[model samples]
Target: MPNTESLNVAVVGTGYVGLGTAVMLAYLGHHVTGIDIDERKIEMLRRGELPIYEPGLADLLHASESRLTWTSDYAAAIPEADVIIVCVGTPPLPNGHPNLRYIAEAARSVAQNLNGKFQVIVNKSTVPVGTGDWVTRILEDNAPDYHANRYAVVSNPEFLREGTALHDSLYPDRIVLGSASQEGIERLRQLYRRLLEQDFTPPEGVPRPAGLARPQFVTTSLNSAEMIKYAANAFLALKISFANEIAGLCERVDADIEEVVHGIGHDQRIGHRFLVAGAGWGGSCFAKDTAALISTGAEYDYDMPILQAAVDVNRHQRQLVVSKLQRHLHRLQGKRVAVLGLAFKPNTDDLRDAPAHDCITRLMELGAQVVVHDPVAMEQARREWSHLSYQEASSAYDAVRGADAVILMTEWQEYHDLDWEQAVASMRRRLVIDTRNVLRQLPSDTVLEQIGRRRVQETHALPMLPVGASSVHV
Candidate 1:
């Protein structure tokens, strides 16, 4: 089991990925200090107010406030920290490669503050393959007097979804630690021995597998660990884009893509996790990490045509949503459009490369008066896209009320469970676009047209398209 003795750890970055990691580690009996550059965000965290919207995160942060601390001062936190995990963002550059400025700054920040003994510096951010080496080089360059043997750089990329980050962190399928040094690997493994033990209690209400073997901890070289993260996300994104591409074909020949997905998903080898056809995959990880992998491929003189196709398909999926809307009204000008969700996906307020951004922006350019609503992401939407007209509604019904057309952008459960009867009665026209196909129930008056599928305009019935079909008539 992990040593119950106090572990002084500092987690850099307080964004969704960082805060979740810090809070989970703190809950696992570690004294964790969270560091971020934003003063306002630091204040919010200090007051036990989580800036992001992940379920079970705020409760854990509030519960562990004494054991967990927040600070904007990286130098202050680093000295007392035994393990410093870098969780900084690696946003995509204009050239479609990862901009490692934040990662570089974070490494420099850690180097400047290192004065004492051995510390395990773990990179939990999704970065390029060689980042661990680069981070090590930076530390070596800056900390000339610091003992080389006193510190180690490790790669442990996070695989948490923004919405289910806490759950994923607390009960991961596997915890991967990548470092060339055996000592570094052992340090990380010892730190997480609690998770690897048999007698250790699992979190409350989380059912342990009766006969199934407990999750394994995989340790390897830093390069393998980094590649694992990129490979996993890229493959999932590829699956999503592939399903979406199939949905487009299904629309043409009137084949049921849902049934096709069901048939394919049941194939044990092709499990049904990310096979749902939608507008496209978004959020921070998929795009940035995929681009990073492609960049790495370019750097190594290798070809990743599959990843390139996945990126291309995702971009095209957004355009397909816009094209579907254009078909309905012929012109978006002077139309009152209501968007149901603004965040990339449900349960998080991250709007990075969200499909809604493209849909809303295109609608606005066409003169559509767009009214937007999300369960918790409206505030972020308001801040990012101030030029667009956004209305904060109490519910999805309010957003759609009196609108000419409504688009289901983010697949929030509230939108899934919306009172369709009331919504249709309140709307001027019975027009609705299910971009994510979150709605299954049909309203009496509303015309529900799913993206990558044909329009269904009948009472008490919905049309299902066939898979791998031809033609764009839908």
Candidate 2:
């Protein structure tokens, strides 16, 4: 069993990262105060209501209710805390650089509320490299003289996926800590002792992995730590783009992408994880982080052709959806097209950079009558995409009713389990575009299309081995 004492932790920003971190820390027996500037969000949290949607988060919050506090007042939460975690938003600007205004404001608030007690300020927000140093300067300039040495800054980037954020937090692949202050690092390490040792019982829904003894404890310089977050996200985006490129080639060559991916993925160096060819990746991280990295490169007079190509390919992929529609229907004008799934990915209502928006925009521009549906993100989409003129469907089946063509933009389980036969019966036409390649079966007369795959008419069988020949013989 791990030996540790509960400490008071103040988490700034009650968004996805902040809420998940605060809840996880509280679950580990720490007294955590979740601070956000938005009064409505704070009030909702205080009333035991979640401001955002994430699987297993509400239950975890309920489980850790005794140790958790919610407030908008920084002074009320920061002064008595032993550790302060900054998890504010660093949204992207038009030029691709991350706007650090929120980070600066959070730092100033932390500085203004500093107490005599020594505290470690952790940067849990995904900022550009050298942000930790910038945050340190901000705190120092704004903090009172008497508390000059009372706090230390550390860069601790987050790697939580939105849909499964709680599970990712409690069972991370690794925990990265980057700081110059040894004392600060030690205190942060102790704060995560239960996680480091994997001593606590796993939460009810988030079962521990089969052999996840402990997560790696990666220590590095503050700049390296920040770079790690950007690099990791950029690489994952590249992998997906690469797969999409291969899928394009496979279509031209009349080869199945699924078979090709499976054959190459078996090799040790090329494991099958994000090798999926789909509509394209869209979330809070990939596009923003890759753009930030490219922007950082441009600042240093550097050109990254590969990363630029990834971005270009992703944009083209979204446009390709419209192109495919035009190819099949000859023209989109007056055609009723149904789009299934609005969120970037399934299980979360985050529509930031969602491909569905781009596809819908193009379809509408070409005069197609568009209708859309998502299990959980319709309200979010209605709010953010209010300007777009489109019909909203109450269910996937309803979306397809009387539609000329259906595009499955997101791979939700609900879409996968949809009864294609029944759905096709309601459609004006029997055309389906499976961007995610998730549909199991369709009517025999229905026309099905997918990315990186084409219908082949002929099948060639391998030569049979001799009766007495060894199967392994070359």
Candidate 3:
């Protein structure tokens, strides 16, 4: 935590997790070189342009001064660094297993470029339990001359939320460092000592959460650390599935899920975090991790029924939105449907496993003309989902304008700031289905429908519908 000699660090891959860590390490006084195979991404970072949408990352990149640099030359960046962190993506395969091609290639590159000096190789991506050993094996195969004493492989899975990654990294809730080599653990710990103890002052845009407790430094076994990442995400995904299941029941019985969640969430044992009833849980972490966990369980001859059910429920959750629309408009063969918020979540431009994209697809299947909008993720949405025929809107209001029915998927703050009076005035049917439960209430001229509740606990005004107007409580 002192202003001692800086260590040389090389981070491979400049995606969300990789870039966030690189910027934070550079600001912590380490000389960091971010290496990637993508020349376009490298050029963007070299020109002080952000390739992804993460808050405070650009500021940290500019504030890092001479500590951080991005390049595509692995030979120049990898061999000389004291520590190399592999942050490449481990995308899920077709059968739910993780395709670790990137991890294998990264190990091959690092081994081929070894400098014959003691160095720490940390795995920051969310991979399987035995991936640490697999990476070490790849190193052994590629760099046969180097002995075990020359390098150490460690599992240091990331727990960053996309929106607040900068703040989360600078002041983490906990730091998990797992390795078989004590020397490797100590070196990584020294690199993270400042963050572990909250030593440095955070940058301008990065705000530490209120009442932030002392960050816990969890030093344990290599495989234990890998399991921690999967377990944490699988549990969060389970909570979301449970909340949606309760919402389904709440709709049929006319009991509000908002009050139910409040009553249960207030208990000390069960806190209110991912307990919101919504279309479904979607993002880079939950679905991918849950599926991989189930696949890994199967490898051990264990059947994870709960986790499997969670996956099934998530698939059904997206379809629930389409069912609501179908119930309202019986013959959905050409309806102007507006979908607000396209990204998996607010504050991220990532559309990986986003529920809104699935909803748009299903609407199109039913012959509905869908229009989409997101404050910052609209461009990414169009690029990712070009196969789907959905017109992109400049703003949330523009999406809702002349829409037969509007569905809210992502809970961006911009979507919450809509002028409901004018927005609903332009709707053709004046029916609003709040999937994320974002809006407090609908306009008096419209009929309101949300995911969980039915006008019992929440103050969402449920006025009598106009004659012949269709409304769905779910």
Candidate 4:
């Protein structure tokens, strides 16, 4: 178990990272105060209503209400806290660089509120490399008598995936704390000792996963810690793009991309995670992070061709889906197109960088009359994409009814179990472009199109395999 020295922690911003950190800390028996500029959201949180949807968040919030407090007033949250975590959003600007204004403001607010007490100001935000140095400079310039070790700036970037933020926080793969100050690092480590060691007994229903390790603890320089986040996200993005690139070749050779990925993924080095070929990646992180990394490289007079290629392939995947639709229907003008799924990926309402949005834009440009349906993303589409004059369908059945063709954009679990019999009965035409390659084996009557698989098979002679490699007795 961790030290019972309860630290009062202030979490700046109430977004996914902030709220998850606040709730997790509070659940760990620490007094936590979550600060956000949005008063309405603060009020909503106080009323036990979450502004966003995350699995298992509400339960944690309700369980830790006694220890957690939400406030817009920074002074109320910052003064008493021994640890201040900056979790503000750093959205990408037009030039593909992350805008650091929010981080700057959060750091400034934290500095101004330092009331003669030592505090470990942790950068929980995913900022550019060297942001720790920037924070230190801001503190020294603003706070009185702020010398070395008076306050420590630790870069503790979050690695939580949306929709599973709560679970990811409690059961992180590793805990990385980067700072120049050894004293501050030890202090923060003690703060997270219990979680780091995985010593806490599971809270009733929250049984620990089998063989889940005590998360590896890495204490590194602040600069390397910032780069780790960018490098990890960029590498994962590359894996998806590389898979999609191979899928295109598979289409040319009449070989199945699924078989190709299966053969390659068996190698221990290349596991089967994110080896999916589809409309490409669309989430809050990948695009912006990749772009920012490329931009950062440019600042150092380096051009990242590999990252650039990955991004290009992702963009082309969306267009490839459109091209397939064109081949089937030929003329898209006045054709009724039913779009299935809207939010970037399943399990969240975040529509930023969603491939479905690009598909909708292109379909509209081709003069296709579009009708859309998503189990959860319709309201998001309506609010953010109100300019698009597309009809709304309550269910998949309603969306496909009288439609010439259907495009499966997001692979929601609900979509996988869709009633194909009813869907076939409702569609005016039989063409279904499943970008996710998820519609396993469609009914014989329906014409299926997948991103990585060829719709038309080319007759080919099979080469003789090694004796044991072949199951056929020829």
TM-score of 4: 0.93
The true-structure Cα RMSD of candidate 2 reads 7.6
lDDT per residue as tens, model 2, 96-138: 9999999999999999898868999999999999999998888
| Model 3: per-residue Cα lDDT over 1-474, one tens digit each | 234856899999999999999989999889999999999999999899999998778888998847888888889998889889999998899989888999999899988998888989999999999999999998888874879888999899899999988877888889998899999998998888788777687787876667878789898899999999999999999999999999999999989898999999998788899898898988788988999999998999999999999988889989998887776667778888999888888899999999998898888988998988888898886678889998888788788877888898889887788877668766777777789887885555576678877742233433333334443232
Q: In candidate 4, what are the lDDT values of residues 67-144, reduced to their tens digit?
A: 889998888988788999999999999989999999989888888888767789999888889999999999998876
Candidate 1's displacement at residue 154, Å, is: 0.4
TM-score of each: 0.92, 0.94, 0.95, 0.93
Q: What is the Cα-based TM-score of model 2?
A: 0.94
TM for candidate 3 is 0.95
User: What order do you get sorting by TM-score, best first?
Assistant: 3, 2, 4, 1
lDDT of 3: 0.86
List residue ranges in candidate 1 displaced over 4 A.
1-5, 198-213, 452-456, 459-474
True lDDT of residue 121, candidate 2? 97
lDDT of 1 by residue, 1-474 (tens): 244655798999988888888887787788899999999999998888988888777777766677888889977899878889999988889777888899999999999898668889999998888889999999988763777677899999887888877667765688898998787888787667665663455555333456645557988888899899999999999999899989989998987678788889999999898998988999898998888888878887999999999999999988887787777667878878888898999988989889999988888788988888889987887788787665677778778777777888898888888767667666666677888876766654457788555555544532222221221111
| Between candidates 1 and 3, the TM-score winner | 3
lDDT winner, 1 or 3: 3
